[model samples]
Target: METRHLTYPDTPDAYPSVMVLGFFDGVHKGHQAVISHAKRVAAEHNLPVTVVTFDPHPKQVLSNKPDAVRYITPLSRKLKRIEALGVERCLVLTFTKELAGLSPQQFVDDYLIGAGAVHVTAGFDYSYGKFGEGTMETLPYHARDQFTTSIVTEQTRRGEKVSSTRIRKLLAEGQVDEAHELLGAPYVICGEVIHGDARGRTIGFPTANVLMDASYVMPRLGVYATRVKLQDGRTFYAMTNVGRRPTFYETGAVSVESHLFDFSEDLYGQVIEIEWIQFIRNERAFDGLDALVAQLKQDEVSARSILS
Candidate 1:
């Protein structure tokens, strides 16, 4: 899929297109429904499917606590998911203060009409323009007959709405398995293995310290069963810990360290991906190395059982 990044007043190529609009942080099931609807519409109209998404998240620009923003999928991963959904092109609009201030009519004209969108698809609650005054009901009025619109109704699972917010909540609570069900895939973290204090090796469980993307949402601090994939295309069952080393240091920044079972390699500076499987135990300070080692042994047993 082709990617186009644009700022306000900059128009996309004037190709006849069917666009699906959303922030699509996780590209969760509800988002998939909207994109699927747009794909079907594009097929019927003989137009390419275009996915319209924003960067830096509108919340970061609009909310007072911009630094508090975290995402289920960063832009790079989100775009991959959209492309996997068969989208032909992706337009990443830079969300800025000025763009957020546009009126409903201006947004419709600048984005839809100006970009030559012949049809648009979005969730029912989707809104545009300043203060989100443009509802699905108000979209056509803003379109001025330039394009048709389709509103995908609420997508539900287990009697609740499937949403990014819900998935984030689940992840925050260390409910990775539940979040995976909603995401249609396991929650994953992509990072580079960096040098640590080499404490895991001393304890007989060598670990790869991962420096993850700060934009991604961090799961709750705990030891988890995980599947680690190396840049060299090797996969291993692993036990991952996400926490500060309270056992050694009183306080420090949180770290992600994974111990791949029955594996030995020098992984410094290697890029790797970890798929979270299940939370095993909360992070805690043990009395000494012996206690920590014992606990880790138990964790390995549990992880191996689950992975098996």
Candidate 2:
């Protein structure tokens, strides 16, 4: 897909394309429905589908706290998901205070019309412009018959709406299996391996300490059954711990340590994706090294069963 980093107040794109608009944080099932409809509309009209998204999230800038916002799919992962859905182009607009201050008419003129929107598709609840005053309902009024609009309604499963907020809540509760159901895939966190205290090595369970990207919404502090995919594409079953090692040190630093079953290679500086399959157990301080070791052995057995 052709990706463009667009700045505001620039010249309108000459290419007439079908535009899909949203923050599209996780690109969850609801978001997927909207994009899929855009793809279909683009196919019918013989035009490219341009997905318009924002960076740093409007919430981070608009809210009082900048760091309070976390993402289910960071910009990189969101782009990847959009590309996989057969989008033709993606416009990453840098969200700033200036952009957020635009009026509803200004938003339509710049984003939809300016970006060459022949048709627009977004979710029912999708909103834009100052304080989200511009919504799917207002798009047609602002479009002035220049383009058609489509709004995909809420997507739900098992009588519950599938949403980023719901998924985040599930992850926060260490309910990875339920999160997986809402996401329509395994919940993934990709990161680079970094150095740790190397205490797990001394205890016969060497781990890769992953330093995750800053903006990801990490799963709750606990053990999980996961599959780790290395940079080169090899996959392994893993028992991952997200906790402070209280057995070794009192109120230790929180860490993400994954022990790859049947593999013991130094992975410092390498990137890997961890796909969480199930929540094994909550993190707790063990009696000692021996007790922790025994629990780890059980964790491995549980992880192997779940990952299998």
Candidate 3:
């Protein structure tokens, strides 16, 4: 798939194609449904599929406070997911205040018609232009006969809408299994292995300290059943701890460390991706090394069973 990154005033070459639009954080099940429908539309119309997404997040530029806005799937990961969906081209527009100031007609004329959008697909709630006054409902009127529009209705899970916000809530609550169901896949985060206090090794459950990227939304502090993939592509079932290790230190940043079952090797400096499978238990302070070790043994058994 071809991915083009553009700023305001820079546009991709026009071609007859179907364009699907969204911020597409996580590209969860709901976003997938819209993309799936776009694929079908493209197939029927004999046109290539183009996915248009934004970067740096609109809220980051628009909101006065500009919250950190951690992403469920950052730009690199989001592009990978879009490519896997069999899209022909991707346009990642850099969201800026200048771009946000465009009027509804200006946005459609420049982004949609200019990008060769023969047809456009977006979720029903999707909005664009200054103040987000333009919505899917207003999309057709703004089409200007240059393109067509389709709106994918809200996708629901167990009667609740499947959304990036909902998925974030699930992760924050240590409900990874439910988040997985909503995402249509496992929740993944990547990190580089780093040296730690090496306390786990002395206790018999050696772990690789992982320094995760801050941009990835962190799961709630807890233990989880996870699958780890090393840089060499070796995979293993693991018990991952996301906590501050209160027993060892009363104050420190939260850390991610995983004890890989049936595997042991020098992992420092190597990178790994952790795929969260299920929430195992909450992280807590142990009385001492003995207590922590005993609990780790139980965690390993539970992780092995769940992973199996």
In order of listing, the candidates' clash counts read: 0, 0, 0
Model 3 residue 186 lDDT?
95
TM-score of each: 0.97, 0.97, 0.98
How close to the true structure is residue 187 of candidate 1, measured as C-alpha lDDT?
Answer: 93
Instruction: Name the 10 consecutive residues with the lowest summed lDDT in model 3.
Output: 59-68
Q: Which portions of model 2 show Cα errors greater than 4 Å? A: none
Worst 10 residues of 2 by lDDT: 6-15
Q: lDDT of each prediction vs. the true structure? A: 0.92, 0.89, 0.92
Top model by TM-score, which number?
Answer: 3
Cα lDDT of model 1 by residue, 82-153, tens digit:
999999999999999999999999988888888899998899999999999999999988888989988999
* Model 2, residue pairs in steric clash: none
Q: Scored by Cα lDDT, where does model 3 land? A: 0.92
The local distance difference test score of model 2 is 0.89
lDDT of 3 at 251: 92
lDDT of model number 1: 0.92
Question: Residues 96-181, candidate 2, lDDT per residue (tens digit)?
Answer: 88888889999898878877789998888888888889999999999988899988988998898889999999999999899888
- Give residue 160's error in model 2 in angstroms: 1.9
lDDT tens per residue, model 3, 1-308: 99999999887788779999999999999999999999999999999999999998988887785667889998998999889989989999999999999998899888899988999999999998999999999999999888888899999989999999999999999998999999889999999999999988988999999999888999999999999999998899999999999888899999999999998799999989999999989999999888888999999999999999
Candidate 1 wrongly placed segments (more than 4 Å):
none
